[model samples]
Target chain A: MHVSFQVQAGDFSNAGKVSSTVKGILKQLNLGPAHIKRIIVALYEAEVNVVAHSYGGTITCEVEPESVDIMVCDTGPGIPDLDLAMTEGWSTATPEVREMGFGAGMGLANIRKNTDRLAIDTGEDKPTRIHMCFDLADGATHA
Target chain B: MTLRDVVQIVDGTVLCGDDNLGREVHLGFASDLMSDVLTLLADDILLITGLSNNQAIRTAEMSDILQILFVRNKRPTKTMLDLAKEHGITIITTPYSMFRSSGLLFSKGLQPVY
Candidate 1:
């Protein structure tokens, strides 16, 4: 099964909607609870990242019998330093974003912690893309 | 501890999911940051937070946290409560600060989700 969602930047009210929808589908598929939780966590962080930092984005998920692939692509002021952005305490979120209880700089770290595999592509002048895959066979155990 | 016990311990008001007051939560995590809340690994945990926004409810929903206690008399908006109700998440509000709420729950045997 495949699903896609459009995410609007600064849409904090609608943040997590994509993750919620994907989670429902995962539940209907009878995926393990642990696996579903990890997917939701990763997808949610990515979704929020778009809402908090991007101009807009799209989230696409392809669910297979053995694994799930997720791609979040956003147009925005892309990260100039991927390594710094990956750090746990580095963020460029606005004060309003921080007041919303996000921008603690744990978004990418949380995504990294929950996915089996992750790939990020971004530059100061390019759109950001995060690709994540989770192997269903392993459930909570990431390879 | 059962959510009923949580309500009394922290002097909280049940804004939604009153029927679920008897539900038991073994662990509790307190934070205003939803990102920190997402990093928790335990199931059946209760979230105690000062954030009174929709994201708090959304965070609990995504993390599979069934109960949320808003501290410092912070009340959630009607929309936020509605979302919690839709997700079957119990929402409660307390006059106690976040620290006191967590401390009270901890004193009553609710373990921290460390």
Candidate 2:
């Protein structure tokens, strides 16, 4: 199955709706609980990043019998430094974003932790796109 | 510990999921940062946080966290409560600070998810 969602910039109120919907679908598919949890966490962080940072974005998910693929793309002032952005405690979020209990610089780290394969396409003044895949096979080891 | 015990230990009031007070939570994770909460890998975690917002409930849903204990008397908004209810996540509000609430729960045998 395939699905897509539009993410609005600064729309914190509805940030996780995409992840929630995907979760429901995955549950209905009878995916393992741990597999569903990892997908939700990665997609949620990516969704929140779009809401909290980008101008707006789109999240697309392709669920297969053996794996799930997620792509989050956003119009942005993209990351100036990929390595720095990947650092656990480094963030460029404004004070107002901090007040919302996000912008802790853990989003990407969490995404990395949860996904089986990941890639990013981004640059300053360019759109940011994050691609993540999760293995759905039973008994697969997770980080 | 059962959510009912957590409520009494922290002088809390149930804002939602009253019917689920019997659910047992084995670990307590205290943080105001939802990102930190999302990084947790354990199961049956009771999120103890002071940050009250839609994201808190959303975080719980994504993390598969079944319960949240809001400390420092931070009240959850109607949107948050509605979301919590939809997710079947129990919500509790406490007058104590995060430190106090964690300490109290720890003293009462709520293990930490380190």
Candidate 3:
């Protein structure tokens, strides 16, 4: 099955809607609880990143019998330093974002922790694309 | 501990999910940062936080947390309560601070998720 959702910039109120919908779908598929949790957590962090950082984005999810693939693409002032952005405590969120209990800089780390395979396409003044894959079969990849 | 015991220990009022007060939580995680909360991988966690907002409820929903203990008397908005209800997450509010609430729960045998 395949599905896509639009994410609005600074739309904290509706940030998790995509993840929630995907979670419901996964539940109906009878995926393992652990797999569902990890997938949802990663998808949520990715969704929030677009809402909190980029101008806006689209999240697309493709589910197969053996794995799930999610791609998040956002119009952006993309990350100039991928390594720094990946650091656990580094963030560029504004004060307002901080007030909302986000911007602790764990977003990408959480995504990395939960996904089996990940890729990113980003740069200054360009859109950022995050691609994440999770194995649905043996669940051996989870740490 | 069951959520009922947690409510008694913290002198909390159930903001939502009163019917779920009997639900048991095995671990407690206290944080105001939603990102930190997202990093947690455990199940049956009672998210204790002062950040009472839609994002906190959303975080709990994504994490599969069934209960949230809002400290420092931080009452959740209607939107937050509604979101929690839709997800079947129990919400409780306490007058104590985060430190005090966690300490109280810990003293009463609520294990930490570390």
The residue pairs in collision within model 2 are none
TM-score of chain A of 3: 0.94
Candidate 2 segments whose C-alpha is farther than 4 A from its true place: A139-143
* Local lDDT at A81 for model 3: 89
CAPRI category for model 1: high
lDDT (10s digit) by residue, model 2, range A7-116: 99988788889899999988887788899888999999999899999999999988888899999999997988989999999999988778878898999999999999
True contacts kept of each: 0.87, 0.87, 0.87
- Identify the CAPRI category of the predicted complex in candidate 3: high
TM-scores, all candidates, are 0.97, 0.96, 0.96
User: Which TM-score does chain B of candidate 1 obtain?
Assistant: 0.97
RMSD of 3: 2.5
C-alpha lDDT score of every prediction, in listed order = 0.92, 0.91, 0.90
Clashing pairs in 3: none
Error in Å for residue A4 of model 2: 0.7
